[model samples]
Target: MHELIVIEHEAEAGLGFFAGWLEGAGVRCEVVRPYKGEPVPERAGDGLLVLGGAASAWDDEGYGWLPATRALMARSVESGVPTLGICLGAQLMTIACGGTVERGTAGLEIGAGAIEPLPEAADDPLFSALPAGPWRAVQYHYDAMTALPAGAVRLATGSQYPNQAYRLGERAWAVQFHPEASAGIFASWTGTSDMDPLRVADLDARVREAEPELEATWRPFAEAFAAQVAME
Candidate 1:
């Protein structure tokens, strides 16, 4: 069976709906938890999925496995392996490909928000199926991809953060938002940061309300990625 290597940065930010979507598409997944000392693969499988994390991509000293992770991302993209990098993973992909990642001047983009699909996305393998209208997505990141990697095609953009999504090579895709975050996982993220309880509660409610739309928009995207890997 073909495998999709999933890199889970932390325990809390597991694959969520993405795991189920992939499994339903008949693609097996092998998760690697570097935080728990699991080795990052030197070579990728049919596909690679690097999930979200609180840590910055540049914090190699704090997260000793980051350098190796970056190398894995680069290798996967360079070799035309199907790869998807979410949130911090996207930043790492940008940095690994000689792009730039910096603290966002727009402050935190937490909670449910809108992401606009670009014109290039109309023909993209994974993004082509997404709705043409603005899509709501879960956002929780302090850092942003200020510059995309060389030769990358901008698949999507947002008002707060212009670099919302991009396709690196023929098969490598990266997105700044979290399409895989379930309601429970999103709720857990709110309590971690210092914020007003009332505000967190409000955001949690909004995320809950957006669940259906998120599922409609992202579930197909995940399935498409998995199907692509299965075909290879």
Candidate 2:
């Protein structure tokens, strides 16, 4: 069994079903809440996961722990570790791997949305088993990663967001949406500061409407991550 390192950025953005998925696969997880200034472990296992955050990846000074976090993710990439990042975590991974993260024009997608498979995704090992066409994924990010790093494969995209998912090197991957989110987890995200009251309510309804499909997609995504961990 592989030991997974999960970085929690906010009180709301915890691991959700990710921890359960890993445990189900007989993997151990050690999560660190860096926003609370928690102590950073000197070493993270080869399998690493970085969750979302309210803070931007550019604001390393505001969140002083960013440099350290980036260092950890960078090490994971360079060491051939299987690293996965979600939302802001994805942006962090992009920045760590010499990519650009900037404000997106989509204005923060709050509810369930679609991600289409890229032409390059056909050869991807991780995404090969996943469904193509419009698949539902939960998102709540204002900023996005623009260009991908070298050797990164563009796996998925949507109408509004161009780069929904990408894979770095062979083992490192990052997605702009949250595959770890469950129904309860999406409910907890119902009233975040970034979303207005009316928009939040509408988004929650969309989440409920799309719950089944979202869960379906998330199941394989979670399984893919688990499989990557198992490989390490």
Q: List the residue pairs that clash in candidate 2.
A: none
What is the C-alpha local distance difference test score of candidate 1? Answer: 0.92
Global lDDT scores for all candidate models = 0.92, 0.82
Model 1, range 21-125, lDDT digits (tens) per residue?
Answer: 899988999999999999999988888999999999999999999999999999999988899999999999999999999999999999899999888999999
Report, for all candidates in order, the number of backbone clashes.
Answer: 0, 0
lDDT of 1 at 190: 95
lDDT of 2 by residue, 87-197 (tens): 988999899889999888667776688888888777776677677656888887789888888778888988888999998888888899988887678878776465578
Q: Which stretches of candidate 2 lie over 4 Å from their true place?
A: 194-196
Top-TM-score candidate index: 1
